[model samples]
Target: MRLSRYFLPVTKETPADAQIVSHKLMLRAGLVRQTAAGIYAWLPLGLRVLKKIEQIVREEQDKAGAVELLMPTIQSADLWRQSGRYDAYGPEMLRLVDRHEREMLYGPTNEEMITTIFRDATKSYRDLPRTLYHIQWKFRDEVRPRFGVMRGREFLMKDAYSFDLDEEGLKQSYEAMFVAYLRTFARLGLQAVPVRAPTGPIGGDLSHEFHILAETGESQLFYDAAIDDVTREELLAADASTIARLTRLYAMEAEEHEKVAECPVPAERLRSRRGIEVGHIFAFGTKYSASMGFSIQTADGGQVHPQMGSYGIGVSRLMGAIIEASHDDNGIVWPDSVAPFQVGLINMRADDAACSAAADNIYKQLETAGVETLYDDRDERGGAKFATMDVIGLPWQLVIGPKGLEKGVVELKRRASGEREELSLETALARLTAR
Candidate 1:
């Protein structure tokens, strides 16, 4: 992608209404634009990052034996009514009347709808343990939707629902998703701690919320410091015992953490930090199935409500969460795994013919080598080009300047670290491609 042909509308001045670093930088970096209060139109760059996060979530879900299927944004209000939550869910539910005067809503969650689907499809225990998920947009009608995408009223989400015939099957299914969430966040360059949390409207006795630590986060969390040492591979291969070991450690949100006297961990082992809730898992046994009359036949030919669990990850909110956890003074320092583009190819001397030619050739080489490169071929000053690249925060910046090109070298810089090295074009291409 060439910057001259791109639609990035970066700004020098930050929006006055923007409160947090992620909100301010997202505006300044031209990632998204506010179309309404608590709603946004994801610009090209922002959409790329959102899609990358979505794909990662999908891959992890697949690994955990969950099948993918999309559900509609709009759901029948009757679904909620059948589940006995039509009146219970408050103003956050975006309820509306359709053309026929039928009550409908933009779904805030899909527990009822998924339960209905499972009931209609499966009649016996043979179809017992099935996990289905979808990545889709949801509307909550937040009274005060601020902090950019972090608390947006309209946002993307990955919601998975698991159906099992028995408690043991439900436990196993929940553990799979629990481990998958750990791996998902780790791959996205986040250190998320799973803390015991309230189920709220989801109505589960067992629940955990995965929070990513950040200084500007909304939730105050208390957790054991040992959570920081867990690895992705270890979590992915974890069993019931492994999960129990981690869950036994002290971890809770501020509201629950306030009862410090009840906490098991000593003062030294307990760590407090502000964190953003990126993922949540619930093992709500028969909450929706029983309410919605979703029952399967047991081996003894008796009807039994299928146990269920729901797992959710805020797909769009993750962009803001990542920025909150990863950005520096300059701009977002995107991790390579989720960066919009792996390399930013800047023609520092865009007006110089030699520099332009070299940059063009290098860009082609990078593309041919399957590296996602953004070529800054705009007729702009070197400083401006560098600043723009930094603001976007690709993993690497390949600068082709007149002086460097004349010396048979190009400057390669790591965005995370302000480290630079002058190397031959061949060498630069090799390193970037290898990454």
Candidate 2:
């Protein structure tokens, strides 16, 4: 992508309505624009980041034996009626009427719809233990939708549904998703702590919300400090015992937290911090299946309601969460795994032919090497180009200038740390494409 042809509408002044750092930075960086209250049009740069996060979530879901299928944003209100939640789900449900005067809604969640799908498709225990997922947009009528995408009324979500024959099977399926969530967050360069959470409308006895610590987060969390060292690989291979070992540690959100007297961990081990919720998992047993009359034939030819679980990761909200956890004073310091572009190629002297030729050559080399590079070929001052690159926060920045080209060198700077090194053009290309 070349900045000269890009549609980035970066601004020098922050929007007064943006109360959080992620909201302000997202606006200033030209990632997204608000079309309505809590509704946004994801600009090109923002769309790239959203897609990257979606793909990572998809890959992790696949690794956990979940199959992918997309679902529609709009659903029949009868689905909720059958599940006895049509009246129970409050104003957050965006209710409406179609041309035929039939009750309809933009789905806030898909539990009832998925349960209906499973019931109609499967008839016996042989089809048990199936996990299905979709990445799609969802709408909720938030009374006060603020904090940019973090609490947007319209957002992208990765929601997975698991069907099993019994409680034991449900536990196994739930563990798989729990571990997958840990690996997913780890790969995205986040330290997500799984805290025991109350399943409000989901109506599940067992639930956990994965939170990333940030100073400006909305949720106050109490957790054990040891959760910081848990690795993705370890979680991937974890068994029931291992999963229990990790979950046994004290962790809860502020609403559920009682007191230090009730905490299992000692004062030294317990840590309190503000965190943003990015993912949630639930084991709802037969809540939906029983309510919707979804039953499968057992080995003994008896009808039994299939146990159920749902796992959700806020695909769009993660952009804000990542920024909240990772950015500095300059701008967003995107983690390489989820950055919109891996490298930002800057033509520091865009007006100079020698610098332009060198930058063009390096850009071509990077393209040939299968690198995602954004070339800043705009006719702008060197300082302006640098500032824009910093605001966007690519993992690596390749600085090409007349001075560096004349000396047979290019400057490579790491965005996370303000560290720069002058290396030969060949060496710089080699290092950038080494991964």
Model 2 Cα lDDT, one tens digit per residue, 1-435: 788999999887889999999999999999999999999999999999999999999999999999998889999999999988989999999999999999999999999988888789999999988999999999999999999999999999999999999999999999999878878888888878888988989998999999989999899999888876667667656556657877987789877776668888888888899999999999999899998888889999999999999999999999999999999888999999999999999998888988898899899999999999999999999888888989988999999999988898899999999899999998999999996
* lDDT of model 2 at position 429: 92
Worst 10 residues of 1 by lDDT: 233-242
Give candidates' CA RMSD values in order: 1.1, 1.2
Per-model lDDT:
0.91, 0.92
Q: lDDT for model 1, please.
A: 0.91
lDDT of 2: 0.92
Q: How close is candidate 2 to the true structure, as a TM-score?
A: 0.98
Candidate 2 residue spans exceeding 4 A from truth = 232-242
In angstroms, give how far residue 39 of model 2 lies from its true place.
Answer: 0.2
